[model samples]
Target: MLVRLALAALSLHAVTAAPAPQGATTWYAVSTTPQGDTVSPPTHWYAVDTSSTTTPSSRTTSSSTVASSTSSSASSSSSSAPASSTAIVSSKKGVGYNDEYLTRELAISWAYNWKSRRGGELSEGVTYEPMLWGRNATGWATDAQLGLDEGASALLHLNEPDIWSQSAMNVTEGIDSWLTNMSPFYGKTNLVSAAVSNSPEAANLRWLQYFFGNCTQCEQETHAVALHWYSDSFNTSAFKTWFTDAYELLQKPIWITEFGVQRFTSSSNVTQKQEFLEDVIPWMEAQPFIERYAAFGTFPGRFVNDDGSLTALGRTYSETV
Candidate 1:
């Protein structure tokens, strides 16, 4: 009965459905008001499931196959991998949270926020990469550019543009904004393409295909494919399927910026998410194409509680090798 994926209270069984409806614009975002104020939207289910917990599944992988990386893309020797100093750590493990304390407690290697600024007391040792979350990444360049000089090797580009609720941009709009806001970093750093949702719907995953097809030079600017996955399924194989598809489609390094279970039922529990993490985290770490990753746990419900105590799911994720 040990469970883990994201929601521990629920069954550890792998989920088969996307947590949210396809094309749903209900995901979270960092938006800007007309008055130039940065806005934090409601976290809702997307932050981390507040209703349940998951176990680290004792580190068993249930997937039939991870996306088979091509002979060339899977292990092709590239420039020596970036040193540990890069904003996205070479360890390829991280947590999505604003609290420096949680990151320190978990001892994860890197961190990221929706915007480009490195938030509060995050240690200098924990490489912090910046993201241009939405279309209006106002003033993101000046701050993120500094990473170049600081040896930050990666820049997370637009958020989920396919989902109207996230970045909400069409292919043309997304590329235009990327060229304007992200192109400058093309050679200086690894530009992670827009992170799209893991939903099987055509729009969610196809967005990247459309983007790369249209922008002939975009592949040069993009060092890796930024990806995300959210579901209620307990099947670890499903996670692998998603990863395989993305890898085969893009044939580039993959950075799993966000991936977790969204507990929508009373059965959700930490063991489920724990199992999910145990299966996926280790798999991701071993994969050569999976350059980096961070579980989605911005609020207390995920890695820790409101009192700042590590939850069952958190314990597994932190202790995971």
Candidate 2:
């Protein structure tokens, strides 16, 4: 098997079902807790199995039909095409694990076949985009050099340049660095802008706009917008607005490199956190302009556990993909 999906071995306590009224057979659905504990939820076997089988077959048929339709549509001129003919295409879901050494393993735990940084593949379907953090690293290759050496599908630049604890490059320094180092990779590979914090000034949306407005060369070179959002707000409206606006303003495909409901208060509700994941994930997946999204925190409440078992959020993410 290629191991394209995250498979976790949870500690399950199976309870024998009650003798099903003599002649009846039943099936049960397994549910996991946020702590990675597994439990069997009551399920009607026939309904569950029938629905599962039918859904996949129907989706396969639909996918085939859509592929054919898209091919036929591509042959027509853009001006002649119908406005409502375009369908929403989903981008791949990825993991944003902070550990460089556990890149492949964390990717597996989260069912992420795509990574943000380059590394050895843990399985057959893995792919990645190389990153250039900052000027402090030793023996770091420039973006252009890395692109030539690795042949990446895309290249990521700067971690969080607006935050002092991360890349810490001021606006002037960021522009200067981009012009000198990052600009060389312009035509060689898909150039992604430096990911900025949600902070004010040029670090977030403002910083991205500033970069494009000031640096003609940088603007011309940019191919995608990289964004990061961490918030306690569980609602999707706020995120949707920010995301859609970024795309409309920048006129570039957006990559939500990092996004999650971070615990901002001591009263942060677990239910609300899970709600955020359930709602926001599907919303992002439906956006055609969103090229990719990486969920922050693969360990504990974020998704996976220390022993490699998947948390509730992790399971939701895996199933969503």
Candidate 3:
């Protein structure tokens, strides 16, 4: 497809370096363009000799525009840490994409937080969050252990349970699972609710009713809400209406883990994505209840290109940051 070719071109911006030996530690300083997209020939570079046996961990540090980071744990964690702090892992400006393909150094090299599926290494100054998929108790246990070991600040619960293709849990089952597996981590780390699918069927009011009615333990144990938003209509009102309704019901801080104007069905919608970001970014940044948010991805027609170069959408999204 033409889109794939464009993304292939986008990845060409990455710096060429000798691959690290298997299990060897390597460091890279991911530089950003004036537009805030990742590019080659890092502005500054440093590498420390690391042991092959070092158990990876996730921490984030920042200096002006640069985020100093170390990596461990794959995508989907939460945090209340300040975004500008160079010594903490925060969820403030995050991303959800393929860590193996795009990489922290390639796609979201400048970002503060990011996630994929399983745990992996990241560039300096970026925090990685681990996600629990479906009702898989095994996966949850694994991520929970990783969180405890790495001292993660927060934990993202199930993926979109409202969608069949994702977690697909009924209300009773969702609450029960949360109490059994996720509640124990309540005081240990912030527990972000399972992200609901982006539709009225996953209505905030309805879902909350089911959850609050059944799970009394999770009511007080949980810390924040995670959300996913995508709109066919690219406008301020569309974005505002959905979030406003959800905010009214939840009355808790919100973290928009995945968001975009529309799915990447065509390249012609670049302007639409840009317009949407221009309106939404400032609004979300100003809202007191919004804890953190990450755009849908870094692919073509999304925020940035596969190689982390800024697209028009990326430019608009990074304007305030």
Q: Top model by TM-score, which number?
A: 1
The number of clashing residue pairs in each candidate reads: 50, 1, 13
Each prediction's whole-model lDDT (CA): 0.62, 0.51, 0.52
Ranking by TM-score: 1, 3, 2
Q: Compose the digit string of candidate 3's lDDT tens values, residues 170-222.
A: 56667878887887777777777877645543333345445655566776776
Task: For candidate 3, give the lDDT.
Answer: 0.52
Q: Write the per-residue lDDT of candidate 1 for residues 1-321, one digit (tens) a residue.
A: 001223434432222244543343333222221111332333322321111222111112323333343223342212222232222233567766754334445546677766677766555456788888776776888888876566566888877665443555667777788888889778777789988876543255566776776676776688888888877667888888778667766767788887877652233576777877888877876676687888876455677666655667776776665
How much is 115 displaced in model 3, in angstroms?
7.5
TM-scores of the candidates in the order shown: 0.72, 0.62, 0.65
Model 1 Cα displacement at 88 (Å)? Answer: 17
- As for lDDT, the candidate ahead, 1 or 3, is 1
What lDDT is obtained when candidate 2 is compared to the true structure?
Answer: 0.51
Global lDDT of model 1: 0.62
